[model samples]
Target chain A: MVDTQWPVYEVFHQQARGEPHIHVGAVHAPDAEMALVMAKEQYCRRQACVNLWVAPATAILATEYQDGDMFEHATDKSYRESWGYKTPKTIKTSDEETSK
Target chain B: MATMETLQDLDAPLKSAVIDLLYRLADDAIIIGHRGSEWTGFAPILEEDIAFSSMAQDDMGHAHAFYQMLHELGEPDPDTNVFGRKLDQWKCASLVSLSSERDWAMSLVRKYFYDVAESLRLDSLAKGTLIPLAQLARKLSSEKKYHLMHGHMWMPRLGKGTSESHQLMQHAVDTLYPHALGMFESTDADSLLDQAGVCPQENDLQQRWVAEVDKILSEATLKVSVQSSPVYGGRVGEHPDDLATLLENMQLVYNLDPSAKW
Candidate 1:
């Protein structure tokens, strides 16, 4: 079968002004204008939406799933943690040092 | 004159004219909505598929609003008025009922023309003396604002896009322009609607529509001939055979079980 669909566009919409535009969904369109219209109909029509944006799916730079483990924490890094610095409340006194 | 806020404000002839206007409004919305929805799965692209389908839903909702208004004036419920009516009883303009050969250009032009007319009429009603229609028009215009936007987005793109596309769009306009003009075909209620201070006659609406359409089409590099005769008779319920076929699909489920709550 032939692949007859247009390019995909990632959709982001904001529920209010000065708010973040969260990723709502994607649509297939020839250009950003149609993509914006599509994003509106597909994602914003039924919801409380104040604004929308559409970018070509090809324009997105994404990490591979196989590289997902690269985001995990490295071992032997506990020194940076707050628990690593935890200690009893003790003062270093000259008397204690002399006794030692 | 004061606004006619309810059905009681209408005398016998005035009520008849009002119902006539309502039927035309509701019928046009329903048929074009049905036609637009045929592109649901088959549009050239998925986004447009969603767009057309979305507009179709809006049109249907508008139709429902008109039907509900008619019900307030003693017509049947929306479903029965839509599904139970015979082919000859339909008052939709021929432009809306005309079948497409799965042509996107035809669909776009038809919707563009109809929606523009709808928006203009809604504006007239929104400011008219029929208080209920005015209220409904004001409410529906918000949704219609986007629909007109969609038309603006596509008309120029397809008209100036490619040679073939431009020609296809031109052909679509030239072919459908007459039918579109038919949308304002004179009806018995035109005089009454005017006398009732609802709005000007349909021909005046048609003139404004043509001017608006002309300006937009010029911007899009498309043209419609003034010499083309308007296809009439839809206002009086004479439609092409396609309406019956379209209705068969539209009312298929309803015809199966009119008693069903769905």
Candidate 2:
């Protein structure tokens, strides 16, 4: 059967200035202009929002949750955390005192 | 603001009239929203597809809000109000329940025509003596501005585009123009609404709408021959078959289990 339905677009909403655009929902439209109109009507009725964006679902590249290893973090990176700075702080203090 | 006492003191006739009017308004929004939703994923462009879908959702939302207001007045619950009722039980405007044939030109024309009518109607309601209705109208009116803008923007663009596009839009306008007049049909509660300052005179509203739309169409280089006789039935519950089919689809899940929490 010939496909009759339009393509679906993902909707994102920015609630206020400086806020990140969050994914709200999706709507189907034949073109981008129409999608923006539909997004405004579907997503922004009551909520206060300064901006909206709609993108084609096919355009997004998402990682699959089943392939988990790529997203894992290293547990041995303690030196990158704030606690690692404490050791350097003591060393710097001793060095400054000795130089003085 | 009129004192709450005035709103609370409505007579039986006026209350019935208000209920009748509310049903008409709510049903109009519901049916049109349903029709608009059908365009989902099928608009000519992705942006417009989202735009039309969003507009459709807004119409349904407005319907829900109106139905809630009616419920507070001792009418049926929103579920019963929208789904459980028979076709004849619906009080939407005839213009809304009519199908758009899924034609882009027709959809745009119908939307532009209806938005013009709805915006004016909502403007009148915003000034209603009834506080809650007035507040609701004001909120709806705010959103209507964008809806109207969307329609206004499309009318000229499509009407003046390519020859084929222009012809399609013109034909759509011709097809819908007669039914469009039905948007101004007066309910039996007209006098009651006017007396209570809930709505202005229909003639006044119609005249203003005509003047505004005429200006827009002229700029679009389109001339619409005004129809002498307009078809109207929604106020009294008469509707086309499409409305029945649409209601069947919309209420199928809801009707399956009226008592179940979905």
| lDDT tens per residue, model 1, B1-262 | 7788777888899899989999999999988998988888898866678778988999999999999989988999888999899998989999999998799999999999999999999999999998888999999999999999899889999999999999999999999999999999999899988988887799999999999999889999998787889999898979988988998888898888889885
How would the docking of model 2 be graded? incorrect
- Quote the positional error of residue B164 for candidate 1 in Å: 1.7
iRMS (Å) per candidate: 3.1, 5.9
What are the TM values for chain B, all candidates?
Answer: 0.97, 0.94
Candidate that would win on lDDT:
1
The Cα error of candidate 1 at residue A62, in Å, is 4.4
TM-score of chain B alone in model 1: 0.97
Residue-by-residue lDDT tens digits, candidate 2, B1-262: 3423344566788788888888878888888888899999887665567677888888999999989988888889998878788888988766677777878888888888888988988887877787778788899987788888788777887778789988998887677777777777787788877887777766677788889888888877777875546778767778889788888888898888988875
lDDT of 2 by residue, A1-100 (tens): 1343878889999999999999999987666776777788678867989999999999999889898887777577778789865556888899999999
